[model samples]
Target: MVATTAPPPVERVAPQPPWAAGLSDVTASDASLRRFLHGLPGVDQVGAEARATMLATRSIKTVAKAWAIDLAITMIDLTTLEGQDTPGKVRALCAKAMRPDPSDPTVPRVAAVCVYPDMVPMAVQTLSGSGVRVASVATAFPSGRASLAVKLADTRDAVTAGADEIDMVIDRGAFLSGRYMQVHEEIVAVREACGNAHLKVILETGELVTYDNARRASWLAMLAGGDFIKTSTGKISPAATLPVTLVMLEAVRDFRDTTGRQVGVKPAGGIRTAKDAIKHLVLVNETAGDDWLDPDWFRIGASSLLNDLLMQRTKMATGRYSGPDYFTLD
Candidate 1:
């Protein structure tokens, strides 16, 4: 009888991270994009708006309120995106991110200091070893009308300058014109250009014209490998409304259900008061579930929201209104 030998055992392949699974298949062609995106469930404006309004009424008093305030501070992307964004301004913002309130060491620091790509190095230098991250906005920013080459170069420069996170704007014109594949390709290219840095794709919801469109854009960005889906650039009006944010939260929730990926959601612009920030937290808690309550999975993109959160936190601690005078403006 001939001796029989068992074949060598096959090596088991490790599973891809939930976020990366099925991405290659979806991005293969324009037909696939249309089939996937158009197949997503549509958003109901009235229902989403009503849900946000109801959540806005959630009341958190005393200890719970204070906890929410601190959490909001940690979720802030302390932003300063003006043409006059000087190195001095960037350093000042970095200082605030490091020490939100010099008077009280108990107060938590902001999440990151967001600045133009040119000022990323200054932010990185100032925030070094302090636990605060440096985030830069690239890809032609608020208006993504530039060529893909220019956008990729802009993103690479920020990454080379040590930006910990890259906030890139999608080509709104392409998305609006039914060019879903073009937008997806751009996001994929930018995600590649970002290398190891986290990528946040801005939908600029204000320009999308409808909740359905915003939902579509949100899904498109996530499918293209965006770590976070941002609502706006804060340069336009009607930025970061409650209803729009609710729609985004819903999209992310469904995405997680479908892909087992917990992508982040950022509602940028127009959220100035602590009350507004808390409302957003409630929306996140109730809608996306508490799994996304942490800073790693949620962010508030604002320049002034930090001060408001500080004032409220002080009020909760000491029985008096701290006012804007207490917190330094960066």
Candidate 2:
């Protein structure tokens, strides 16, 4: 029975890169570190609603200023309903809303206007003179369930339509099924399709159903060359929780530590009130530090949120409350 052929030499998989190793550590230890991580203290825990109200009122003067500044820097990404956002409508809205008045220097322009692929050209043309970017949701947005060819074509078309940023949704179904490689490859392919446009991979954490999954998705997206990792699609309920944001920001921080590459984070959906916005800002500051607090690294995707923020700011600057229609929206 003698001469069994020698087994072919085994191929060794390369060791994890430093960045990968660091991310692994961050995700691995997140559970234990949960209590220490930054988050909002419970208002209910203050013994009574009346006491909480008193405490909240005392902080209003200080918090109002911070809220105003943060609001001014917010990027309202409007992934509007198809027919609701006609080219003429988008153009008029951009023209009126994005113009910076010298007298209102405190009101910073929004970072970008995010829209669907069909509306990208309109946004690009409308936002051309203004410094605001035209972002398109591509790669089967809200649910990235499509053939690779279809997804790639979608991404290519969005970039061709003058999208400065491509917000592509990841294959959550694959990721949830434990098909991490498939998810990673898809992100890489879409990122490649983006060309010069920045790639913002939407994890849609609401569907991930677990904080661990969100962190893993965040790491995988960043590893596969995502310029930013965003939260929800705004179509889902229970969107953009503080714990989820904490986990994603930690992923960004860890990825930066490992690879020296900085990635942005966006928390979208259901983030309407000014207090909620400030809490997000506080989370970003405490977790990702001051550097990530800028519009480049952070954004809040909201339609109603901006108006509330503008109202709060108007109240602070002029010491009086403004009506719901303070900032016109066409």
Candidate 3:
């Protein structure tokens, strides 16, 4: 019988980077974040309780009015649509809503005007006195396929053109391929390129393919210094789902728990109806609490959602259905 050679000892792969390992530590100590989230009674569990405990019951009209006010107060970030090309039009549209009615303190200002990097200057110039921020989708947006130099240049150019926020798409391919370090490094470099502007790292959840990956990406982005972790670019087929949002919120909660850093979350794409918006609001209320409800920590990236909300509000107030054209393009 031939003697069998002894198998060579297997080499052990090293643990993940410091940032990745530290995610758990950071997420554990954020008691305030946990307290706020846990304290908010979930509508699913306490809807009846809420209805019974209200100081006074609200009529349908009152509920409609309240929804109108909520819609008006909502921070809507309009991502681009295929037919809408000019930044001027986007600016005009945002400007009309920027002028908050002094008579109605209930009406909150529009959040910000988001656009392609080339249009940042136009949006910034148009929204100069309007108090609306100019957000640019940079760093090989919707497809983090470019070289590091190109991504940095893209981010720097957007900032130089007056972008208040840079929404960068992470390298999903690398992340999926088990190259977490590559993803982490890319996000850090882009964050550095952002300068003082806020960085929204898009994980494109639909493409991530699993809740575990979504959670991992969320932690990775936060650890890599992302100011916000956004879901979807709205360019893909399957965009923003409730389950995905749940995973992300958990990640945010966990991140804050450990690092004491407050990271924002934005759910973009396929969020069209008022009921859908309310569901997201409910999620925020339950998962992240009152603190994250504001535009500072949360936002809805939509194109036609505002118009539908506005139309519904007008109908509820006037008791008549308004035509689609009721909302002017500008």
Which window of ten consecutive residues has the lowest lDDT sum in model 1?
1-10
Write one digit per residue (lDDT tens) for candidate 1, span 1-330: 001221333332444444434755876888877776776667877889899999898777776787788899999999999998899988888998999999999989988889999999899999999998989999999798899999999999999999999999999999999899999999999999999999999999999999989988998999889999999999988899999999999888877766777899999999999999999998887777777888999999998888888888888888998888778976
lDDT of 3 by residue, 94-178 (tens): 6645743333444566788788888878788888877778888988787889999999999999999999999999999987876
Pairs clashing within candidate 2: none
When 1 and 2 are scored with lDDT, the better candidate is: 1
TM-score of each: 0.92, 0.79, 0.78
Please report, in order, the local distance difference test score of every candidate based on alpha carbons. 0.88, 0.72, 0.71
For candidate 3, what is the lDDT?
0.71
* Residue runs of model 2 more than 4 Å from their true location after superposition: 1-60, 63-74, 78-83, 100-105
TM-score, prediction 1: 0.92
Residue 300, candidate 3: C-alpha displacement in angstroms: 0.6
Q: Tens digit of lDDT per residue, candidate 2, span 91-138?
A: 765654475322366676777887889888888888887888888898
The most accurate candidate by TM-score is: 1
lDDT of 1: 0.88
